[model samples]
Target: MITGDALLLRPWREADAAELVRVQRGDAALRRWTGAAVDDEAAALAWIAGQARGWETGDRLGFAVVAADARNCAAEEGELLGHIALKDVLSGDGRAEVGYWTAARARGRGVAPRALTALTGWAFGRGLTRLELLHEMDNTASCRVALKSGYERAGVLPAAPPEFPLDGCLHACRPGA
Candidate 1:
């Protein structure tokens, strides 16, 4: 687990499936960015299973963000703050893309950026050459997170908006950049 001052990033657990589903379902932000399909209990279960499979396959990894130092931000220690992922991994070339979401209660608290920064360092230390972050152009908050996490804007992808709506912005950072 990667520990931050106010958050911890660790592997997902079965016990967290319900909370994960709660965060994903009925969340407009998630739907806007991810078209989240974990809208029902069964889909949530499948999503958790898929993450496990991704871990086994070595192509993707998902981490659950929690309150660190037992802060008790939301009733108890290790409270769920959000989630982050490193996917579309190019193991041969040592590159990957990152995606993340901060829970409603955790938004504006720097959870996403801190989790992202830690994950970026971890991936790069494991021999990744670059890490990328992409988001809809209108998501200024996400843009801020990417920049604060040390990524530089690459360009806009005209094709990305059609699939998700709105133009897309790509940002990237090198291992030591």
Candidate 2:
């Protein structure tokens, strides 16, 4: 597990399925960004299982963000601050696209930036030279997080927003590269 000052970055576990579904179900923002929550237990199980398989094969890096403890602003274990991960990683490219979100209840608390910084550290430690963060333009909060986490606005994509009504902005960053 990768430890941040106030959060825990760890692999998705089988037991997290039920609680994960419950946590995201009623949050419209999360559903818009992450897609509808799994309404059925079996589906949730399948989703978590797929995440496990992907991680084992190095196809994806999924980390659950949990509060350090009661004193931390983040949620407790069964609860999640959100998720941060690198996707579409290409071998020999030294680059990957990053995506992340904070649980609705955890928003406005600087959790996302902290999570991004932690993921940046982890990715750099693994030799990744470049990291990209993308978010719909409507998500100014995400934009702020990326900027605060040290990413520079690389460019914007028109009509890239799937759920939210906005364009998409791409931010790029690297660690000592």
Candidate 3:
């Protein structure tokens, strides 16, 4: 389990499937950002199982955003905050693409930035040289996360979405590059 001052980034477990489904359904922003469909039990279970397998094989690393307040969940079933992950890892280049989302209630609280910083630091420590974050041009919230996490604003990629007129900013962070 990877940790930070106010959050914990732990590997996914089978027990977390139910709570994860709740989180995903509850957070519309997450669904929009990730384009993940979690409308039914079967779909959610399939997604969770895929996450567990990815963790087991070292293909992808996923993290759950747990708040620091112990009583938060126990007393109030506290906020899930959201989730973050490093995907499409390239072993030879030591690079990975980062993605994240914040729960609706958790928005504007800097959850994304904090989780991003912690994840990127852990990735670099594990020998990842370059971390990349891409987002739709209109996603101002994500731009804030990238900027606050020390990512350099790289130029836009034309014809990115192909079907949609989605121009995006490619933010990058390369430690000791």
- Give RMSD to native, each candidate: 2.8, 3.2, 3.2
Q: Candidates' lDDT values, in order?
A: 0.83, 0.81, 0.77
Q: TM-score of every model?
A: 0.89, 0.88, 0.86
- Pitting candidate 2 against candidate 3, the one with the higher TM-score is 2
What is the per-residue lDDT of model 3 for residues 119-152, given as tens digits with 9 covering 90 to 100?
9989999999899999988888899899999998
Predicted structure with the largest lDDT when compared to the true one: 1
Measured with C-alpha atoms, the lDDT of residue 114 in candidate 3 is 89
Candidate 1: regions farther than 4 A off: 70-77, 160-162
Q: What are the runs in model 2 whose C-alpha is more than 4 Å off?
A: 69-78, 160-166
Candidate 3 Cα errors over 4 Å, as ranges: 69-79, 162-165
Q: Model 3 residue 8 lDDT?
A: 70
TM-score of 2: 0.88
Worst 10 residues of 2 by lDDT: 70-79
